[model samples]
Every structure is written in structure tokens, then in C-alpha cells.
Target: MILEAVVLQVKKGMEAEYEKAFRGASKIISSMNGYISHELQRCMEVEGKYLLLVQWETLEDHTVGFRQSTEYQEWKKRLHHFYDPFPTVEHFEKVYTLES
Candidate 1:
């Protein structure tokens, strides 16, 4: 599995709007090919910050397939404006799991 992690720094006063938009946007991503599951986490230490952790079957499924798809365009439209500065997204592979 490939893990895609996105840390969003939302503009002040945009948290509610961002959450609503993200709820809508999540559906688009969840329907895509190779999409496994995802979680959206709000930061308690810092307001207006969120962490998105998504799982895909492979890196190509997210980097190439999803980003190149029309759904991603919709995703961008729904959620991009809420960011103060664009968030940096990174991908990872499961090296070790303690819970398993």
C-alpha cells in the first residue's frame, strides 16, 4: 500500500468552509481507482491545520491516475482556495507497523 500524506494550513476563519468543502471532495477521491481509504485529522495544537492521510494501491494510482483525472480538478476547485499557501503533500510506504 502507498500512503499519501497532506498537511494543510488553512487560512484563518476558513476552517468551517474548508471542512465542508473537504467532505464533498473526499467522495471524489474515494471513488477513484486504487483508492483504499483515508482519514482527515484536525490539529489540536494549532487551529486551522489539518492532516490528510490516504491509502492507495500504488503510488502511480495517486500521482498519475488521480492527479490526471477530472475528479482531481473538481477536488482542486472545492478545496484549493481555502489554503493560505499551498500545502505540501508527500507519499510513504509502510516500513513497520506496531499495531499489526
Candidate 2:
């Protein structure tokens, strides 16, 4: 599986609006091909900061399948404006895991 991660910083005073928009945008991504799951995590220590993690069956599932699709445009419209510097997204593959 491919893991996509991004650290987002929303514009001041726009956190609530951004979260609401993100909720609306989640459906768009979840319906895409190869989508496994995703989470939107808020940072308690830092206001307006968020961590977005998404799992995909393969890198192409996100870099091509989703980013190239028309649905991505809607996703961008819903969430992009809230970012101040614009988050940089990175992908990774699992190397190890431990569970009880």
C-alpha cells in the first residue's frame, strides 16, 4: 500500500471553515479507484495545523488515478484556498508495523 501524508496550515481564522470544507471534500477522494482509507488529524499544540493521511493500493492510484481525474479539481476547489503556504504531499510504503 502507498501512504500519502501532508502537513497543512490553514489561514488564520479559517480553521473551522477549512475543516467543514475538508469534510465535504472527503467523499470525492473516498470514491476514487484504489482508495483504501484516509484521516484528517488536527494538531492540539499548534492552531490551524493539520495532518492528512491517506492510504492507496498503489502510488498511481493517487498520483495518476486521482490527481488526473476531474474529481481532483473539485477537491482542490474545496480545500486549496484554505492553505497559507500550500502543503507539500509525500508518499511512502510501509516498512514495518507492530500491533498487540
Candidate 3:
């Protein structure tokens, strides 16, 4: 699977709004092709930082299929304004894992 990792640095006091927007945005992404799962994590040391991990079948499914779709526009509109500075998103592939 392909993993898209998005690190969000929200503006101070915007964390709740960011999470609310993300919950709505997640629904849009979930409907897209090749979507497998999503997980949202918060940084303990940094109060306004979050990590969004999304699993997909392929990179194209995100870069092309989802980003080019109208849903992405809405997603951007809903969530983009909450960031203090735009987040950096990167992709990765599973290399190794240890089961719990």
C-alpha cells in the first residue's frame, strides 16, 4: 500500500476547528478510488501539530484521481485556512512492521 503522510501545523487555538474540518474532509477522501484507511495523530509536545496518515492502493490514486477531482477543491476550502503555515505532505511505502 502507499501511505500519504501529511503533517499539519495548525494556528494556535485552531486545533478544534481543524479537527472538525478534518472529520468532514475525511469523508470526502474516503469516497475516492483506492482509499484504504486514514489515521489522525496529534503531537504531544506540540499542541497544534497533527499527522494525517492515509493509505491508498497507489500514488496515482491520490496525486491524480483524488487531487484532480472536484472533491479535493471542497476539501481544500474546508480545511486549508486552518493552517498557520502550509503543511508538507509526503508519501511512503511499507518497509517493515511489528505487530502488537
Candidate 4:
């Protein structure tokens, strides 16, 4: 599995709007090919900061499949504007996991 991680710095006073827009945008992503799951986490210590983590079956599914498709345009339209500086996306593969 591939983990796509991004730190989103939402613009000031836009958290509520961003969340609402993200709710609608979530559907777009979940329907895409290779989409496993995703989670959006809010930072308590820092206002307007969010961590977005998405799991894909493969890296290409996100870098090429999703980003190249028309659906991504809609994703961008719905959510990109709220970022002050465009967020940088990074991908990773699991190394280890510990669970009780």
C-alpha cells in the first residue's frame, strides 16, 4: 500500500468552510481507482493546520491515475483554494507496525 501524506495549512478563518468543502470532496476521492481509505486530522495546538493521509494500492494510482484524471480537477476546484501556500504531497510505504 502507498500512503499519501500532506500537511494542509488552511487560510485564516476558513476552517469551517474547508471542512464543509472537504466533506463533499471526500466522495470524489473515495470513488477513485486504487483508493483504499483516507483520513483528515486537525491539529489542536495549531489553528488552521490539517494533516491529510490517504492510502492507495499503489503510488501510480495517486500520482498518475488520480492527478491525471478529470476528477482531480473537481477535487482541486472544491478544496485547493483554501490553502494559503499550496500543500506539498509526499508518498510512503509502510516499514513497520506495532499493535497490541
lDDT of 2 by residue, 1-100 (tens): 9999999999999999999999999999999999999999999999999999999999999999999999999999899999999899999999999988
Poorest stretch of ten by lDDT in candidate 1:
17-26
Instruction: Show the colliding residue pairs in model 2.
Output: none
Clashes of each: 0, 0, 0, 0
Compose the digit string of candidate 3's lDDT tens values, residues 1-100.
Answer: 9999999999999899889888978899999999999999999999999999999999999999999999999999999998878988899999999999
Superposed Cα deviation of residue 36, candidate 1 (Å): 0.3
RMSD of 3: 1.1
The alpha-carbon lDDT assigned to residue 95 of candidate 4 equals 98
Model 4 stretches with alpha carbons more than 4 Å out: none
Of 1 and 2, which scores higher on lDDT? 2
Order of candidate numbers by lDDT, starting with the best: 4, 2, 1, 3
Candidate 1, residues 1-100, lDDT tens digits: the string is 9999999999999999889888988899999999999999999999999999999999999999999999999999899999978999999999988985
Cα lDDT over the full model 1: 0.94
In candidate 4, what residue range of length 10 has the lowest lDDT sum?
79-88
Give the TM-scores of the predictions, in the order they appear.
0.96, 0.98, 0.94, 0.98
Question: How big is the positional error of residue 56 in model 3, measured in Å on the Cα after superposition?
Answer: 0.5
Clashes of 4: 0
Query: Model 4 scores what on Cα lDDT?
Result: 0.98
lDDT of 2 at 81: 94
For TM-score, candidate 1 versus 4, the one ahead is 4
